[model samples]
Target chain A: MKFIVEDAGAYLQIKVTEARIDAAIATPFKDKLREIVVKHRKPVHLDMANVTFMDSSGLGAMIAVRKSLPDNLAIVLCAMTPNVERVFRLTRMDRVFDIRPDAIQKEANE
Target chain B: MRLKAVVPPKTQPMFHRVLDADPVVVRATLTDMRHRFARDVCDDTLGRLELVMAELMNNVAEHAPVATSDRLPVIHLCIVRHQAGLACALADDGVSLPDACMLPRSLPPAIADNLPEGGFGWFLVQNLTQALCYYRASSRNYLAFNIPFMEREDENLS
Candidate 1:
């Protein structure tokens, strides 16, 4: 559930620090991300490079967060590992979410 | 003096664990199980196995009937590496699994306005594993399935 959210003026960039998003952290992860997105009211770019594993529960949490956002705002998933990517691909959620292949470069932002 | 020939140990890899039906414990068990056969199986196969196991085990944790005491339901899980696939068996003393889970399932329809958050667990479980079977005996539920190994490119060529 450890994530660092940076306010990038026009949008927000979130880097999830945890290695696995399983049933253990899915609820809190959804709640926290939903809170951040609702408060900021900005498009979000979720950096999922660190997450090596995600189950159906984790995918459900991500879907919940997506549903919480305003119609105009977007949640873009970035740099998902193979394990995390498999869940989305198998469930066909990849078609629903805006998924990008590049990681949010921390150094370029600074 | 004639000495008997030494017997070599079993070479196949396997894993077994007994844990409470809790999300945290389920996560740890899946991680350890991956490491147990990481060398024997490829990552593609292991990842599929891990996902199926997580979905099945977490369902038990999420659906544990309300108990008067603080005790959690118990789950027993075992996995063995086979020639063509990884065989998995799980038994839990939780509520009886719904009959619909074992039936053929498709992904929840993707509605544009309001997407479904849940209902994807059993779909993923049914999609990833082969010969999935379930039964309830006594007070425990039993589930068994196999995750077939991905056919390697070299194997396909040969």
Candidate 2:
């Protein structure tokens, strides 16, 4: 799995360049997110536009990444495809993280 | 005078495949099936089927213990068309769930202090499907369930 990281001024944007995020890439994805969180020490926005599918393992990885961050830090997710967003809603993780329709718009508004 | 009549069953598999239990193969098979079924089934039904299969197949890939020999494991999946919606049946030659760990029917509490890293697979599956059934027989585990075609407004997060 490949993730392209960018500085979005207010928050760091990480776009997942994979069609599926399951057990095959969950561990590595989580590890990379953690590394970015520590290095940037800023709110992170995950752009899941390319992610067409996510399983329980992928959901667990998101939760794990959220837990690994400091109490004050936030991990926001944005631009999730319908299939990926459905997993978040079904698992109720949508309530846990700050999810938005577009990261750039969210940042500009804030 | 006597009369006899026969009616075919309302439910029958529209698509079925048996594939290696590898994660890559599972992903590819599901993607192909989703596209093929997209035109036949409603979007909600297709999404639910994809979610259920992804979790089930991933579970098998991650936890299913390897057999004593070098041969790889395999799983069978079938999607049946029903009068109301769709039905799925999956069978795998992997290790069965422990006797103590029954299928979870409720969502895990969304607590921030003690968020769970895993254990949400069966919960989502149960909520998304109807007539859910799981049983182990002849050294293979079988899971079968039905999903309605109507739109599920409750699934929307907003």
Most lDDT-accurate candidate: 1
Off by over 4 Å in 2: A106-110, B1-13, B99-104, B151-158
* TM-score of each predicted structure versus truth: 0.91, 0.86
TM-score of 1: 0.91
RMSD of 1: 3.5
lDDT of 2 by residue, B52-131 (tens): 88878877777756656365568899987766777789999887866533455567788878898887888877778888
Give per-residue CA lDDT, model 1, range B1-158, as digits (tens).
99999988656788999999999999989989999987778888889999999998899989988775367889999898776788899999999988888789998889988798889999989889999989999999999999988876224211
Query: Model 1: per-residue lDDT, tens digit, A14-52?
Result: 999989889999989999889988898899999999999
Which window of ten consecutive residues has the lowest lDDT sum in model 2 chain B?
B149-158
Q: Superposing all C-alpha atoms, what RMSD in Å does each candidate have to the true structure?
A: 3.5, 4.6
